[model samples]
Target chain A: MSESLVSRIKPVLGLDNKWWWDQAAEGVLAIQRCQGCQSLRHPPRPMCDQCQSQEWDFISASGKGTVCSFTVLHHPKFPGYDYPLIIVLVELAEGTRITSQLTGCEPDEVDFDMPVEMVMQRDADGFQLPYFRPSQ
Target chain B: MTINVSGEAAIAGVANTEFSKNSGVSELELASVAVRDAIADAGLKPSDVDGMTTFTLDNTDEIEIARAVGIGDLTFYSRVPHGGGAATGLVHQAVMAVATGMAEVVVCYRALNGRSGHRYSSGVAGPLLTSDAIHWGWYTPYGLMTPASWVAMYTQRYMHLAENVQDAMFEIAHVQRQYAAKNPAAFFYQRPFDRADYDASRPIVSPFKMLDCCMETDGGSAVVVTTAERAKDLKHPAVIVKGVAQAAAADMESMTSFYRPEIARIPSMDIAAKMAYEQSGLCADDIDAAVIYDAFTPIVLWQLESWGFCDLLEAPKFVLDGALRSDGRLPTNTHGGQLSEAYIHGVNGVVEATRLVRGQSVNQPAKEVNNVLVTSGVGVPTGGALLGRSD
Candidate 1:
């Protein structure tokens, strides 16, 4: 199949590309911080879940955390995605947990509590996808 | 306000479409078929139903369902969010409506073309970058993208906490598959899994094999609820809605409740279990059977522990000892859970609980079941309810 055909079949959201590219240019990993609790959250919401407060501020994180958990995907659900991609749940120092893919090492090398840091990788659409790597 | 425990509600009717990897039907059609079957099973007409409930993720609107089924008027209708946790919560809403005389007869339904339609296993995109996605974006940029990948984080931590915990997660998958093997209506019926099969299965996330995950199926299920009095007059015996409860804890978020003090604990489900136990006036020991929402295998372990069936860190031992088997102390998911039967957003679990109480389940327990406990989705703000055999 041609590239445009695949793009038509699996449309990529414009909002995601803009946000990811913005972070990559700045070389900073940011999360939406709920104004009410001053806590970081994922899947950015219009309102704070803790206090139902809608106000949010972009906050840069230390980008340092331990691997709370991980999975080695042997079956890629989508085409072009290779086998054995390390998907991880990272417990950030800011006291929140988030899910992402782990890169920079072999799948077997990834373990629980292994200190990891973030790295941006470009997708087929030139959108930067955040993947993790061992800090050491 | 005191709920009348003696005056219970029953599941007078049950119905569902065939479970399969592909169902050549729209979600609306699937839902209608299940609803029609349920009405017929109750020996009643669609016009008789006055109340309805379903999950938040379901695409079929209540008004659409009401119109499609040709029901004249609706007195009560509700939609519960939070994935699989809405399973028994649907019953909770229906029972309250019936018990309060808000609606005489209520039907709860869930329909999905999960496999042939939208597959949840697909990777995350920017639209998912909502507040939840923003949080995951921080991590996804690093690598966690799917539900199994997200849950794998907690499961690994749980295993790290307990050394004796063998592949107990496999025990849960194996049991559900075993029950499904005997259930002709199950998606995995006639195909049983063993420890070796589980081990050989590809890993989705660490500690979770492909076999550990629930299969995506295209199907629909509906249950009819009516007052004990009305149910007694219907075509089947009344399976009383003994108790119902929905709960969410502080710092609770979808799939990622790790910010709380104890990442391993499910405080929301704990609260729901306690409320159900107290309201029903029945202990865990009184539950003759249960239909725990098993969207993922590790959740079953957490639910069993949180419900006080066993202490923390002992869920593996509980399952390995055959405690959750059909003939075991607590027969669970007798119709095959989301793991083996189908994942209609946990509504099928309500159907199984009703069948157990009605003595119509394919994997009926050895003992006479008086109390059946059914739970909704896990890893999010969830719901649960207890169904009893009316006297």
Candidate 2:
């Protein structure tokens, strides 16, 4: 999508979260995996809740998940986005659930338990975000 | 340690600004007016008020309200965090303050121009620098930026498990509107809606038509809390604070705590339900009236189940069985709630609960109202209070 056509909702790049955005811009979906217990966490936090270990690093996600739930938002339209936006909560193969937009699919076509894979789409804000689409 | 603060404090007065889409006044002015009215209703002067409390998101500060209301306070001012979830928590804090002699007269208020200025429905946009905002950043990039979107994640999963839940949700909205129609103070006064209207309404997030979402209202509400002993000499009947509690489950997020064992069950409220009953020595069956927060319609049913009003999967039928009617087994949100009344966060529900205990509600239930269950926000770390008449 062209920059002019996209609506750029910028990410908040804090000291703890800037890395996650950097990884997404590189077309990779990465999440925090506690080195102490290997328990994966999303919405990356500073320390591992499972082990309370401050020492942790990111792991590349499998890019595959199933739709645990989904919703189509129609009101309060945002810029650079289509009406009737589809948002999905996916249970990733790596045992963590993530929230991402489902693109390249009709609202009626999306359902619970549907398989999807991650794809990178840059928003008008000049930053890339991970989006999911139906997988064969 | 049980730490029973039950009946130690009581709500002596309640007041509210007229519900409107635009109040044409500053939030501080709204706070001042409501606080003054509440204090006078309690038969107390401004000098009698020594403490104040409100939510952090509320734009008006305690000192600002004190100055505007001509209150000269020296001790006890606090702010509770979280959004609508902090409603009953405000009472909890006041009860603690009054019970412990930290302050004699504590007033809790929430005043906001939610619809006219800084509408929450417009969705949040900020520096995104706070810890909570940072958490929201993960999903906002994907177009999940609004509160409705956050709650829709759980609603969709709930429907998957309870196939016929939509019928119950539609009925809940319709019935609440019916109650709202009777409430002269309600935003939807004289305008009752039915199932067909719910279906015809525009979609907000899936599973939530326009009626499913509460109106963003510009209003303010205030309550007065003092020791039970002091309340005995006040103008109106004292509504004893039987139980006050704030609870958060493990790994609780503000709104999007979706990784629970059951995506549908509100764990924080479950914890709150247990705590409130334990503190008050009252059971779910003891409640004659309830004011469950209705920021969204689906949460009301979720609360009914979490609070043990019915089985987890039986909430749909429980509500469909006329459970919310004025003559039903448990009348709920008789003031129409945020959906039809007004959204001053959930503090308005607290005021309604007080009115129920005082037998002063516009839509008072037919049964002799003794105990009332009031809840804060749901779909997040939540709180609840059980209020009863101080016979």
Candidate 3:
């Protein structure tokens, strides 16, 4: 096994990197609103996958989604990693789905379709990995 | 009510690039080389091919492959999705094209420099950046960043239900590596593994060990599909495609299918096995040999149980008794399989199936192989087929 790296320097990117990144930076979630099917999308792409149309615009989101599924990791795959991390598949209010880590709670506390919102956290790598918290 | 028939779709030709960790060739180049070799193997020219089928995940598209391989035109060309599940499904699509007269000669191929170019073993970087990535982002902070980690959860549950039948899974790996050790083309050829090796291997997940996982490789393999009538006049004996089927169960995801009624049992495989048996008119007793997908060792055990080769909980016992060995009741993964051989998205399994029916396999079966069962991936939406000797 290789020696694990410690005290890693994390690089942070500005919201200008991508539209979705910008939305994350502003604390207001945004998804691509398809002109073809009028469906909303996340992690913004160039075109609508459903209709394959190039006409898409940014739409502000409710920052609310339901947990479609989840898995609790009892083992840390990497060094400086903590165990019992909860991961959930969040289906956004617009019906667009995304995967994020559930935070602010323990593993058994999470359930399917449980409402959640994105919460960013700095990992051991110094990068802000998106974590989710149960919605009030 | 469906009528079932048993026959064969002759394998007109076979070709594959040398297996290696680094091919130093573009995926398109690799695919073209294999296709050309397959065309020549059939004693036919490139223009003879009228159809093509491959995996949707493949970088090389069907039209691009046709153009690169110097084919004039194509009447049928398509791609199957669901990763490794499309392995045998590609051949099935080609057989259908030829059988239905949509095309005379069809080629099915998979070419990937998976090791040198793109490593799927790396953390799930691609999916994390897309909306799909965002969806997965919900999980990654929880530390589920790799496919192995996702599969590990289900494997643990399976082991628990089987009352800690870890030996059954290890036994399947033992048999596969054993065959691979004898076959010169296998990566582990001349390097046989035993139960101790499996036991000593490091754990990837709770139940899956390093040895249980398949290797990542770079190579391309191609199979030519033509009518049984045409195969009779070809260069090699016709290894007909007897039956083929693909299925996706409810609540299916890429690797995270925890929403299913039973995570231990792959309902998709059950659906696929039934369809394949019905189409081929052959049950487990009729199969002379098999080349089951072994992406993970536990999947092999589950597949055996689901296919009715043994009782659900009796898988470990069945494997311990050497039922899956080359000299056993039903020889499996005679080409070493993904575990010991190369993982060309399960396409190599199809190549071995063809060899078994032709009586020309490096790890040939003990008895005459009248019928052979070949399955594609097990997890997610999967596919399978039964290949046989054309009378």
Best TM-score among the predictions, by candidate number: 2
Over B1-391, each residue of candidate 1 has an lDDT whose tens digit, in order, gives 3655434677899888798888865677678778878877998888888999998889888776666556768999998887777888888888888888899889999998899888877757546634565666656776777888777778878887854454677777888888999999998889997888788999788877898788898999999988889888889888887778889988976787777776776889999888888877888888888899888888888888878888988888888889889889898988889899998888888888888988889999878998888888888888788888876
In model 1, the runs with Cα more than 4 Å from the true position are A1-136, B1-7, B129-132, B163-166
Model 3 lDDT per residue over B1-391, tens place:
2533235467888877778898765676678778877888888777888999899889877766665556757999888987898988898788777777898899999999888887877767554444467557756888887777877778888877786468777887888888888888787888987778788999887777899889888888898998888889989888877778889888887778887778987788888888888887779898888888888887887788778798776677777788888788888898889998888989888888888888888878768889888898877688788888776
Model 2: residues >4 Å from true position, as ranges? A1-136, B125-129
What TM-score, computed on C-alpha atoms, does each candidate reach? 0.72, 0.73, 0.72
Candidate scoring better on lDDT of 1 and 2:
2
User: What's the TM-score of candidate 1 when only chain A is evaluated?
Assistant: 0.77
lDDT of 3 by residue, A1-136 (tens): 1323553233344221255655555665677787877867655543343443446677776768889999987764544445565778889888888777787877888988788987766544444455679997
Candidate ranking (TM-score, best to worst): 2, 1, 3
Model 1 Cα RMSD, 1 decimal? 20.8
